[model samples]
Target: MSQNTFDGVRTAIIANKVDGIVREMTNTLLRSARSAVINSARDFSCAILTDDDQLLTAAEGIPVHVFGAQLQAQALRAAHPDMREGDAYLDNNPYVGNSHAADHTILVPVFVDGEHLFTAVTKAHQADVGNSIPTTYHAAAKDVYEEGAVIFPTVKVQTNYENVDDVIRMCRTRIRVPSQWYGDFLAELGAARVAERRLKELVAKYGVETIRQFVTDWLDYSETVMAKAIESLPAATLRNTGRHDAFDPFLPDGLDFGVRIDIKPDQGRIDVDLTENGPNVDCGLNLTEATTRAAVFGGVFNAIPARVPKNSGAFRRVVVEMNEGSAVGKPKFPHSCSVATTNVTDRLINCVGAAFAQLGEPYGVAEGAVGVGAGYAVLSGRDRRTDEDFVNQLCITANGGPGSAYADGWVTYGVPCVSGLMYRDSVEIDEIKMPIRYKHLRMVPDTSGAGKYRGAPSFEFAYTPTADPISVIYPCDGQIAPSKGVAGGEDGARAAAWLEDADGTRSQLPNTVAMVLQSGQTVHGFDASGGGYGPPLQRDPRLVLEDVLEGWETAEHATATYGVEFIDTPDGLAVDDAATERRRS
Candidate 1:
């Protein structure tokens, strides 16, 4: 074989090995982690990076977390100019590269042949971060300082293969759950070390020079794949508008957001300009630069499903420009970003997806809007059952996925940022751990966006606190501005939260609030579904009957929206083909 062919084969093998190593690292974290958020929800990410902190490959996790790994590494390198072996740094400050304070990151420098060659990084969402509220997302906080989360900006937590006692002591004193935090810290450390060992094994098998050459070739190949994908798209600029719920006290009516995507096929590049987006408001719903970039990249990856290697190389073909003071851009320091990963981030991601839908045909389809935001709840009080102090954040709100051309949207399939693997808290596990009783947990009816391909039905449920009144941290959206459908498809259902008193009275909850739930009072919530593709009238009559039979869509909704007539037949509920055609026509 020619030299190029040999190198290509070698590069492919090395890339696959590297990906496996990162996957192993992720698995190690999942297995070793103590917090339910990390282990149960799988809200952590692992990655291998060049010593200079360039993108390599990341294990499957939340897209935002994986993309932020580079920033975490850069922070470590900046803080310690001399990053010696056995040094491990931790940080969760958004200003310092983390998407939010909850995602504490661990950065370990990897050395091969006594020369620093790579950095193994892991970002995991900890249970608590000493925030003003017990939860990480303090939506009501006026500023970062008020949020009161311990902002570890490039702090070395370990040195010379030993834990830093002072740092650990400081964290222990500030957070409510010191043991859980420390245990998770160790888990992240373990994952990073796992990556280091795996990298060394690769280096030992193939000389350092050969491995380095493979990295270069792999990145080049990824760039070519991404360029070709962009080049294939028809030369068109698509501008899409979206919105966030009214949470900002300053703006009683909420805000309007917009994204202008300029696709230059000839240049093999697409520019996602968020400069025209709404101004940064006085709330915690703003997106950090890292979060913004991750959102844009999430859209690009969603648009290009081809086997384009996910690294710095593929990202180079997509240009994301954001206004410094915009909600989806660099916010001035002190603006509360505790809830930055969701809210505006989700809106931006949906906006990007909508823009791609404008491309049409193979390049695009009807817009399938992602969920408005993640549902967040903080349960803080003594666990009467265990007789222990407990404060935990419930991060599992199935942000219902949007429908696509290929298939129907999945019910409770995490947001675009998360790779659909972020698991919801097991209902049995939640009841066992927290003082809460699950009254109901199931999909709601008529919640799916209507079209030929319907979006997944939204999840709705109710629960009552069994112990002392616990603070309910509710940070969500999609109520005022529900997920819109593309082309002629119908819009999806809105997300909502409320408390029902024993007397059957109800009090609606705001988009972002830290409230209390009294005993005997039940809290209810619903995750908004995504928009569907194509017109509802064009949907298959058989699919409509199935939806009605499954109770996901009401008989009235099937008839009114899909123009399908379901008749009770001897076999069961059957679609009346003649009546359906007449109604559809």
Candidate 2:
């Protein structure tokens, strides 16, 4: 074979091997992960990076994890200039380049022919990290110390592939689930080792010089592709603003956030400015810089075609600007950022897209569900059955809302924030481990925002604790405020969660986690739907009739909202187009 052919073959094999390595890492972590969130929901990320800290490839993982791991590696290399062959580092401090304290990152240096070539990392989200509260998501936290666990950057947890039992002991003593934390830590270490072995094999087969050239060439090619894609977008500046209910006790005045995006086609760059946003509050909604960047990447990546390779080169075409104290840009140390990173990130992405919509570049989409559902529950006193503290972060899925597109109705029950990556564990599986009984779990009827392309439907879940004493904590918003529609679409319904007791008493669930439930009492949670795009009046009459028949829309609602006239025929429902047009007019 010619030299070019050999290089091409070697590149393809290395890339394919990297992909397989990530898949295997995911499988290994899932098999060993003890929590339902990791093993069942798979809320973790695995990736490979060059020694210079460029993200090469990542397996299917959360946006926060993939982005956080990349940033973490860059920070690790900077913090420890003398990184050695046997050294491995662990970090979760939001201030030191992590999504948040709950997301622990493990990094290991890969070597070939006695030369350090790259690093392997695995980022995993822990359900509990020894916080003062039952769950690490403390909406009331005022500072980093109150936010539970905080791991420093470049903290060597292992040397020469040997376990650093001291660090392990410290972490195990702090977290609620020791066995699970230890298991996950081991899984991360195992994942790193897997990547190292695969990388070494590739180097051996292709030779060191060939592998190095491929990495450099691939990164440059990726950068050019991304730059060209950005340059194709029409040059323009777009601005959007969104607000979440300020239920936090510290931010009694209410909190609001705004975004400004400037797309410069001449420079092939998109600049995100969040300087005019709200100041960081004492509440947990504050987002660290690392978390903010992750959210930005999520929105940008989603707008781009899916086939595009993700690397540092892709980011070179984009620039993000935020004030030092802005909520979305800079987060104060020790603030609870768990929810803000996901919820606020979703809002920022939508705002960016909405701004880009005016550029006429087809670079934007309609809003979808952006809130994070906190399925928190606590069991009071020791469980007589297990003789241990009873605490669990109930498995909650981020339900899908409507997505904006020119064709077809919005995706019903789709993931709004991170898209269709994470899913809810089965109700049976949830009940088996937790002390809750799920009575209802389905899409709420007629909750979609009505429009030419209707928004996705919201969901309603009802559950009651079966154990002697259990408390529920619901950190949800969109009750006093509803997700707004884009263009001419109608607003989505508000989300609400409340407790219904046997005595017919009821009360609203607070945004902060607190003791709010008991045995024999039921709690109902309703998620908000995404906003629709376009005018509802433009919807096809036949589609309206079908929606009514399918139970997604009510007959009366279709007639009133969309001005659709339907008649009952022998076969089924039929649309009266003439009447519908007359009613619409």
Candidate 3:
């Protein structure tokens, strides 16, 4: 075979092997993980990196984990100058290079033929990391110390496959669920071992030098491709701003979150500066450095072409700057940043995408779900039936708004920042885990952003407390403020929630989780919709009629909101072309 043929074969084999390694890693973690977050929701990521710490490939997991680990890898090498073959490090400190303290990362260096080849890393999000509150993301806290747990960099947890009892004991003691924590840690180790064996096999088949060279070449090629893509984009600086409700317990006054992006075409780089953001609060909305980086990368990647391979190479041309004490960027230590990942990070990405839209037409996707939608229900007090330690369960529901697109209206159930991601947990599962019953769950009709291409509709879910008295927490934004539209498209509808009782009494709901519900009371949640793109009047009459018949748009809505007339025919809905043309004129 020719040299080119040999290189092609080797690359193909390595790619397949790397892909298999990640699949096995996620499968192993899912099978063995103790918590629902890991096993059921699959809130974890696995990746293979070169020995020098360049990310090669990662399975479809959390965006933050994928990019955050790349930063962590570089930080690890810098922090641990004397990293050996048998040494494994465990880290979760956001300051060092992580999204937050709760996101524990386990990394082990892979060696073959007495030579360091790559590193296998598994990053998992734990429900609780021994925070001040039951959930690691406490919205009421002020500083990082109040947030929950913090693990520093270069914490050696394993040596030559031996269990580090000290580290294990410390983690087990700190977290609420020790059994789950231990199980996740073991699964991470198992994943690393699996990668190690596969990597060694590749080294045995192909020479170690050849494998190393391939890694270098692959990363270099990826970087070149990313840089070239950046160069192709129009040169311009775009600015956008977004906001989130302040959740500071000490400071009840609301605050604003902002972002500004500067794109440099000549240098083929995108620089994101968050220095003009809101002041730091004692709330959990504050972000750490690692979380900020992850959010920025997520926004950039989402706006760019999806064919681009995600790796450290892709981020090589991007530079992000944030104030050390700002709400959107890095925050001072000991600040509660539990909600940063869900709330602040999300807004950051939206703001960046909004900025990108100004550069040209069809630049980025519109905003989707903005808030964390954390509905925490804690059951205390003694149970009349069992009389055991009345179990208190805290759960979060996935509520998403529609996202706007260039050609079509916003996508319903579309995830922003991270595409193709969904939060899973049905009412049946919630009932089995806790004492709750869902009364009504369905999509909210006519609650989408109205435009030529209409935004996707939002969803609504109503649940009643069945077993014991429970506290319901709802953290959301875009209620008073609607998602902004680009071009001439209209903005999305404002979000709202309420509590309805069987006694025909209804009360407004707060964004916080302080309200307690009785056994018969029901809580209702309404998710917001995404902003629309382009002018509503420009919408096709035929498409408007189709939407009316499909129930996405009512006949009245088509006439009023979209300025398109529709007639109900015997066969189906038909567009009134004369009326539509007159309305447009």
Global lDDT of each candidate:
0.78, 0.70, 0.69
What lDDT tens digits, residue by residue, belong to model 2 across residues 272-386? 8888887777767778787777777666765543355676667767788877676888676555575554656666666665555455324555566654554433323335556
Candidate 1: C-alpha RMSD to true structure equals 2.2
Q: Give candidate 2 misplaced runs (Cα > 4 Å).
A: 1-16, 304-307, 334-338, 374-383, 406-417, 541-546
lDDT of 3: 0.69
Candidate 1: minimum summed lDDT over ten consecutive residues — where?
A: 365-374
Order candidates by TM-score, high to low: 1, 2, 3
Candidate 1: clashing pairs of residues: none
Which lDDT tens digits does candidate 3 get at residues 370-451? 5445343333333445443222333334334433444554343433534434345545655654566787767666777766
Q: Give per-model TM-scores.
A: 0.95, 0.92, 0.89
Q: How close is candidate 3 to the true structure, as a TM-score?
A: 0.89
- Judging by lDDT, tell me the better candidate of 1 and 2: 1
- Highest TM-score scorer: 1
TM-score of 1: 0.95
